[model samples]
Structures are given as C-alpha cells and as structure tokens.
Target: MASEELEYAGFWIRVWASVIDTLLLGIVVYPLLTAIYGDAYWEGANFVHGPLDFLISWVLPAVAVVAFWMARQATPGKMAIAARIVDANTGNNPSTGQLLIRYLGYFVSCIPLGLGIFWVAFDSRKQGWHDKMAGTVVVRKKSGTTRPVEFNA
Candidate 1:
C-alpha cells in the first residue's frame, strides 16, 4: 500500500517541538529585555519590573503574534523539525489574516482542557481543532524543497 500523504506528528514529537520553540523564543526575548532594562530594572518587584516588565507583558505577545502571523510558522521549533503551517485545502502557506486567526484559535484550543491538541491522536487527517478552525495544516517539509503534499481527494 502507498504511504499516507500526510501523517500526524506523534505526541512526543509535538511535545519536544513545543519545548524547543519555547526555549528558543525565551533565549532571544529574555536577553533583549535584559539589555534594554539593565541590572536596575528588576530592583524591587517580586516578578519582572520596570521597562523590562512592561516589555515582557506587552511586547512578547505582540511579537509572537507578528512572527507567527507573518511567517505562517513558529520561529524555530517547527522549522527545526521540518514542519510548517499551511492552508489545509490548498496546502499553501497561510496569509497573514489566516495566521492571526490560527494563532488566536490556539487560545480556544487551550480551553476545555486542551482537547484540541489531543484531537490529532484520533483525527483521520490528524488535524487539531485549531488547524480546522483556521483552515491550516502542519506538514513535514522535504529536505531540499518546499513542496508539500498534494492530495487527489
């Protein structure tokens, strides 16, 4: 039998990818905050403080939105794992609006106890709820090319 054109990422792979992405984003964001605020920034607060605190509170989410929305993929983790986000039907990269919708849908997916993520385990197409809502799919990229799967159905 022919192999499936698209396969869902296994749970462990997805988990690892999340971890890697979080660490990478933190590596970039934290140092930038530190440099902008300096040692005196966190002088008295129990948590983050001063310009650094504001930056962390506000800028981080905005940056995350812009990065994913503009790129149609997460910054590092998905890229490292050869995974990318695209439109489910056309298998094309998402538009900026689609990316924003997808990112926002992540919040909904996280609600009701993250059942959306678990949908991959049972979905025939292995799509999460967020993927469905946003009309997006995550697929593995070929090593030397950008082509994604093409389905006749």
Candidate 2:
C-alpha cells in the first residue's frame, strides 16, 4: 500500500475468481439440496422449493461469503488469484459495514444485465458497481512470482 507498483485486478481475472467461488459453493450446496429434495429437486419451478431449500441454497452461501470476507479480506477465489479487497481511498481493509454493503450490492450490479459488474472493465480503478457502492477496490502487487495476497502490517 505504498508507492510500490500495485495494479488493480483486471476484469477477466475477477470473472474467473467469481466462477471458481460459484463452482465451489455449488459443489457443497447441490449435494445437500439433492439429498433433501431427491432427484425431483431439479424439476421444480419454484424459486425456492421449500424452507430447507431456501436455507441451503440462499442463506448458507450468503453466510459463508460474508464470513470469508470478514476473516480473509478476500474469498477463496480471490485469494487464489492473488487479489484482495481494500478501502478505495485508504488502501486499507474495508470495514464490516462496507463489506456487507458490497455483498448486497451484487444484486444491483446483476440487475441491469450485469452492466454494473462490466463497469470494472472501463473504470479507471477496475472497480465494479459493488466496489463503488462500498468504497472498495480489488488490487494486487506486481509480483514477478506467484504469491498469496496478504495485507502489510
């Protein structure tokens, strides 16, 4: 967070990170849902098949993601990509409130055909709508070799 050669993570890398997270979540959630609802679970027209479905499919992922953000500054996927979220102005870890806002902002970003998420490709700071809403940014150091993303004390 000094004058070092830092770079905002690009769009494609972020997209890949999200894909990884979604796949991981599916790996766990899908099994639980299938076990509870049986094979016919996939045939439902309901957005949420039942209370357990809502708990497993919706609440679980949300809690997991928020917990990861709180504990690690980045989710597993972002950590895999060597990127972390920080306060846009201070380059420090964002507050819990900011993290929550960022999580909720995902819906807004996706609502308009994902134009807000796509905004990262054009934004000078490579911020998606969620980052903008929460005053955060995703960044990585210009490392010559692969390294884990970590905060400097």
Candidate 3:
C-alpha cells in the first residue's frame, strides 16, 4: 500500500503510549520491588541485589513485554490507544526473532542519549532505531476506522 494511505503512529502518540506503559509497569513493579528491598530499592543502582530482584526486575518484565508483543501485536498501553506493531515490510505480525531483536534494540536506541528514539520525530515513517532494526512499525486505526492501515517498505 501507499505510505499516504497508512496512518503511522507519530512520536507524540508513541510517547504517550510509553508513558502509559511505564505507569502501568510501575503500578506492579514498584510495590513488588519495595516489598522485597524496602527503602533501599531506589537508593542504589545495583542491577542484581538478589535472585528475587533479578527475577522481578529483569526476567519478568522481559518475558511479559515480549509475550504481549507476540500474543497481542501491541502492549496494553499501545492497545489502549488503538495502536498495533507490525512488520514494516509486510504489515503483518513480526516473527519471534524480530520481536526479540526489537526488545534488545531498545538498549541501543537508548544508549546514545536517545538519538534513535528522537529519530522518529524526523523520519517520514516515524521509525525509531528499534523499529528499523526489527523491521517493524507502529500504526493506529485511521480516523473513524476500525482497523489500522497497511504499509510497505
């Protein structure tokens, strides 16, 4: 399909979706972390305080987010805003490998003062580095429409 025919999610919508996802994650993560580490949880930068911390902070979130992407095409926050993640070249669900790469690509996107994320604001397709790495795009239902529009490479 022509690019103009698709309604790609822009930076602001993506930002809002991220905010929502972060807040929701906090709702669950904060209490659990606090319960495990007490007041010292926020006081340190240590990544692995214990097995529980490792499980809660690292493993759980990675599994949960990837699972959501694989099963639902979008996270809860993205879904709330009617956005879906798709393979940019095919406008279909991404493969498991692609999704995993996308998740890891987030680290790359964030490492350089978020330049990769900011690229979305300038790119015509609004793809961040992670999106580019995974060959994915975020799209939303077009105005007054029930389905998201398709796009191509």
Candidate 4:
C-alpha cells in the first residue's frame, strides 16, 4: 500500500473552498426552506422567534457530520482540490465512527472563538484541533507525472 502523508493545504485555498461550499449549500437550502414555508414564514411574530438559532444548533452539526464523513470517505471536496483525508494512524480513509468523532470535535474547536481554524494557519503540521482530535489528516493527491522544468543560465 502507498504511504498516505498529510498535505498542508494553503490557508487561502481552504478559505476559498469553504466559502464556495457554504454558498452552494445556502443556495440550495435557503430556497427550499422559503418554498416550503412560503413568504409568510418570515412575517408575523414567529419570524423573530429563536427557531433560527434552534435550527442552526441542531442542523449545522448534522450537516458537518455528513459533509466531513462523505469528504473523508469519498474524497469529495478533497478530490476537487487534488487532496484526500486519511486516518493518521492507519493512513487510510477514516471509519464512520472516526468521522463522527471528528465532527463532534468541531464544537470543541469552535469553543474558544474558532481557534481551530486559526490553528491550521500556524500549526507546524497545519492540523486543526478537530484534525488532531480525530487523528486524521488532509494530504494532496499524488500526481503520477512530473513536469519538465527549464532553467535560465
């Protein structure tokens, strides 16, 4: 088996990818919610209720679980960026239980005002707190071919 090493994704690329993913998710979800609840959903006293926060607290974790699980298992976003997530211990895709644990760890990372995301920017291994907790790493996918280089003398 090939050795799977963790690839440090540059901070900017990761930020951009996350922005794209969030926008895509919002584009799909917002319209679906609007359609289901109708324009009146945002009217009246109920509009100012705490349901949005309630929904978020519950839904966001679930979404993160599904997204990370799929990404780790199938390399979804990582595949798009020529990367992969693998278990640090085994150098293979993480198990479902590991993925769930990883997702749960996100809450911890977010506790101190999202220091986990910052950890990626400065950590020696570029592993976020969640990554460390889950024992997983993201690595660039290996390209089979090398490019020719020309040098000026």
lDDT leader: 2
Error of 4 at 55 (Å): 6.8
Q: Show where candidate 2 strays beyond 4 Å.
A: 1-3, 143-153
Residues 43-102, model 4: lDDT tens digits: 745533356534643676377546766665533444467655667666667877767777
Give TM-scores for every candidate, taking all chains together and pairing residue i with residue i: 0.69, 0.90, 0.88, 0.68
Best by TM-score: 2
Model 1 TM-score, 2 decimals: 0.69
Cα RMSD (Å) per model? 5.3, 4.0, 3.3, 7.8
Report the C-alpha displacement of residue 10, candidate 4, in angstroms.
3.4
Clashing pairs in 4: 7-139
What residue runs in model 4 are displaced by over 4 Å at the alpha carbon?
4-6, 39-68, 71-76, 142-153
Candidate 4's TM-score reads 0.68
- Locate the minimum summed-lDDT window of 10 residues in model 3: 144-153
Tell me the whole-model lDDT of each prediction, alpha carbons only.
Answer: 0.67, 0.86, 0.85, 0.61
Clashing pairs in 3: none
Q: On residues 27-62, what C-alpha lDDT tens digit does candidate 3 reach at each position?
A: 988999899899898899887789998898888888
Model 2 C-alpha lDDT per residue in residues 7-125, reported as the tens digit of each score: 78878899999999999999999899999999899988889999999999888988998889888888999989988888887778899999999999999999999999999999877
lDDT (Cα, tens digit) per residue for candidate 1, span 29-116? 7677768877665465656565666677567866774586466565567766766776777666677877777777777888989998
* Model 3 segments more than 4 A misplaced: 1-5, 144-150
Poorest 10 consecutive residues by lDDT, candidate 2? 144-153
Please tell me which model should have the higher lDDT, number 1 or number 3: 3
